[model samples]
Target: MSTVKMISLRVKSMKNIQKIVKTMKVVSAAKYAKAKKDLLVARPYGTSTKVFYDKLDLKDPQEQTLLIAITSDRGLCGALHKNVSTKIKEEFAKRPENSKIVCVGEKSRGLLQGQYGKSFLGVADQIGRKPPTFLDASRISNILFTTPYKYTSGKIIFNESKSVVSYLTSVVSVFTLRTLNAAPGLRVYDSLDDDLLQSYLEFSVTSLVFYALKEAAASEQSSRVNAMDQASKTAGNMISELTMVLNKTRQAAITTELIEIISGATAAKKDSGV
Candidate 1:
């Protein structure tokens, strides 16, 4: 009886847990859809900006490099932050000793802070609490720009969404000081004066940052949904197993009672006959 009761309780608890996990899976799926939509909306502009940067030939002293890693504020997604953190550290390791760390979201901040100490320059949390926006990305880029460090170039590490439910670790380049801005004759278009060029440069940075943040959010949601689905399945399997056990125990108890009753009746009849 105790075993049956214990199993029953366990199954009940697991059912409750399964419900929660299933709900989360649904919620994350919804969020992922929204995030993916936003990312798709903004990706083209970011891609164009990246192409523009690639065409520019600017090589500063490489004196100060920045490593911006996009992670998440919360964690339920498996190895999402850890994979990005590992990529960040690997990039940081390959850079010049003067490189600084910039983390987007809390997870990367925590993971890199202890390792990099003061080298970790800036960390932006709550960036992923809502679906990413152009304004949010702009604000983050502006914050990085305002930093006292004179970084010539930057590398952004993020998980790029490869498919609806898959992501791959990727890096985006930032030529903070574009050579075209400084040279009037070499400017691709005469309409872009120094101020206009600067503004466009900032926009480029923002766009890139925006892309990274949005994609990371999508990937994070995908991972969360996948994890929750697995959890729900496990819970369901446990419940089914326990239910089977309970049913078998119940059958055994019924069989035992029938045997006892039949034995008692048979002994009474035999004594009557005697």
Candidate 2:
């Protein structure tokens, strides 16, 4: 009986968990759809900017390097955050002394806190609670501009959404205003002024950040949806298995009770000579 009760309890608990997992899957699916739509709309801006920057033929700067990791505070989203953090860790390993990290989300900070705490320049939290906006990107870009630690060349690490169930960890190049000004291809532009270039740099940063945020957001949602779906399926299987066990145990218990009752009645009848 105790075994039967335990199995029954397990089945009930698993059913409840499955319900939560299904609910989470539904919510993540909705968010993924929106994120994917937004990413499609924003792709052009990021691509065009990247193409224009590439045409400048900018030389990789030899000075301090910056790394901006785009992640979220939330977990249970598969390897979305881990992918970005792992890439950043590789970069940091290469240049531990010169690399500085600007974590666009708290997850990166948390992941890299122990070993590379000193390398973190700033962190932006409360990300992914809502869809990322241009304002959010602008705020993150401002951290780069206002921070005392300056960097000449950098990379933005993020997870790029490929499909409903897949993503690619990608890196985008970044250059400081000074480095951009010194690009060999800058000679092609006849009369670009300092103020104009500064504005362009600021805009570029914001655009890049915006693009990364959208990609990361979409990837996170998709990963989360898939994760929850898997969890729900596993929970469902466990519930079914446990329920089966409970039924078998219950049947055995009933069989034993009936057998005992039959034996007692037969003994009484025999003793009474009936």
Candidate 3:
């Protein structure tokens, strides 16, 4: 019933809230650590696949360019999904107007749907939590091969700039496939033997699909790690704020009790004629 008691209750509530936030922060940090590790392990494989694809001289104009846009199914990862979506959009902008987009995550699908509409081929959910197995890779590869992308031949375009390629190569040389032959109007299918060309096309398409999945997995993990880190930081801040509030409430209660004591003493003195 007392003001002090009410204030104490509030302090207790704040402390409880602070405890929850602290726990959440710890959990997020642990998840982030695991995600970071996953990303590191998969980095090399993704890079090598990309490098191998770059070496093939596919210069045919009639070839359909398939853009496998990778992103997270969820959105708690800071600007990771946004950044990827932006990168995809920029890549799309550079294309010759009829590029096909195959999204790997729900986030990517949702973001690109309004813009690309029917051009969006399909979506794969939860592609980031686990390391992509060959089965997973095969599913994506099959999708690419069976889809209209193969039937419609064109140049394959990567969104990354030259600087990015250079940076990646310098850091992870083994993963770097090779310098991409960016020569415009270069014909690709001409150099291959008939059966080899078909095989190469199939392999190339599969490789691209595999690379995309790998990259998507890496990116998603990285994004989640970053998100968890930020969540941890935000939780820390909330705890701090709650602590301050608890302190303030405690102080207010203490001041109220002192005031009541002083008032009682004054009343006694007046009644005693002192």
Candidate 4:
């Protein structure tokens, strides 16, 4: 009877844990729905920007390439962070050892610091929270185009096959950097004459950045949702098992009491007969 009581107590504690897990699962699912919606909304803007960039015929005058990899600040959303980090690492491995990195998220910061250390340059944690203005984009663009980084010193070789305009557009849109009023150091490309192309480039880059952010956010939410869902399922299963055990314990206690009562009654009857 005492053993049965202990089992019942354990079952009750398990039920409480199950309830908490179920609640968390629902919360995560709700977050996932919101994140997914945001991501879908940003996709069209990103796609349009890419299309505009594809129409441009810009050429690069400089040699070094600046790769900006975007990620998330916090990671509870499963392998989303890991996937982006892995892609960045693989890309980094293909580049020259002197390549510079501009990271956008905390996850990127941590991963880059561990992998490339000093190679990482500017890191912006607030990029996702607020969309960057054109002025900010111009500033970053100026630094990349005009500023003489240590890596590009030796006889810089320009790649004529690659469109510099497209590259710039992709980076800008993907990062969501706002366009500046007075564009500086943008005349390097001979083919870039139309003001509309330049404006489009800026817009595209900003949109791309927004899109990337949305995707990352969605990934995070999805991961959390899946994790919570699994947890909830596990909790439910545990609850069911505990309930069964509890019922069995109660039945055993009742059976033990009944047996004791029956035995005592028989003993008394025999005693009376004697």
Pick the TM-score winner.
2
**Which regions of candidate 3 are displaced past 4 Å?**
1-53, 60-64, 95-97, 149-195
**Candidate 3 local distance difference test against the native:** 0.54
TM-score of 2: 0.95
- CA-lDDT, candidates in order: 0.82, 0.90, 0.54, 0.54
lDDT of 2 by residue, 116-205 (tens): 888888999989899999999999999988988878988999998999989999999888888988888988988889999898888998
Candidate that beats the other on TM-score, 3 or 4, i.e. the better one: 3
Residue 51 lDDT in candidate 3: 60
Candidate 3 local lDDT, residue 229 = 53
Best candidate, lDDT = 2
What does candidate 1's lDDT look like per residue over 13-56, in tens digits?
99999999999999999998888887778678778877765666
Ranking by lDDT: 2, 1, 4, 3
Pairs in clash, predicted candidate 1: none
Q: What TM-score does prediction 3 earn?
A: 0.67
**Model 1: runs farther than 4 Å from truth?**
57-61, 178-196, 248-274
Residue 105 Cα positional deviation in candidate 4, in Å, after optimal superposition? 2.4
